[model samples]
Target: MEVLGHRGSRVPGPENTVEAVDAALRAGADGVEIDVRRSADGDLVCVHDARLSRPAGRAIVRQPTEALRARGIPLLDEILDVWAGRGRLICEIKNQPGQPDFDAPRERTARALAERLRARGWTGPRPTVADLDAGAGGITVSSFDWFAIEAL
Candidate 1:
């Protein structure tokens, strides 16, 4: 059986946050499914809702990485840096329900993801960049929006 964490067992930590990812790894899960979103600066963030303030009451949309870093919520890169080679990160892209622009967010999300993979050299050697042109790798790209899927 594939032992995947349910939003990193949300009861123990914030759903889709790095704390949850760590909790899942400690719990011996073989894989983790994380929701991805494009932050204000076009960087990828591991979060479910478009607005981070929804649950924590902290407005995070359109905030740059440095400002977000001070909030303690790790970015996509920070999370992967810790567990990139330990197990699998099932990245599920989130639908941008309300946004100023559409295509920009999607492309930014993709590029941010690609950058993460490239940073750790996982794009060429490992499970990252799985959705490129056959485009095969280890990453999994999924979404409820048909437009997003078609974009990939």
Candidate 2:
């Protein structure tokens, strides 16, 4: 039913990059699946790994979102822009499983991205952001960490 376009990218380019996601959408994908994480400054980006350096090469672990944007990695807004009318989306929030950054304010990251998508509305037959009780659509909060879910 849902032929999800995995990550817009997995390993080829930057996972979840707008370019990667746009490629999938153009190839007849019904929706996009992407990973999200908070940057050092608590900004959300479409990064799959726990740290950008691991997949990105080098050891720039705690780079700010703006730095990643400058490198053209892609912020949430960029990803959405590329995937607009193409299809649905499965936003998987990255939990930074092994390497924990206690300093990262993940809750704020989630709420921020959630609010952004909510403002966008679905612009579709069943927009994910439309028809919600509050501006809480487009965001499906789920994680192994119960505390995290509760935080959202």
lDDT of each prediction vs. the true structure?
A: 0.64, 0.63
Error of 1 at 149 (Å): 4.0
lDDT of 1 at 149: 65
Write the residue-wise lDDT of candidate 1 on 51-92 in tens digits: 556346544556676776666656887777656655556777
Q: What is the lDDT of residue 142 in candidate 1?
A: 71
* Best of the candidates, lDDT: 1
**Tens digits of per-residue lDDT for model 2 on 23-127?**
776776666788777777766787766655535553223787778777666777778777765656777766644555432344655566567766886423444
| Winning candidate number (TM-score) | 1
Model 1 sits at a Cα RMSD from the real structure of 5.4
The list of candidate 2 runs beyond 4 A from truth reads 9-12, 54-61, 102-106, 122-142
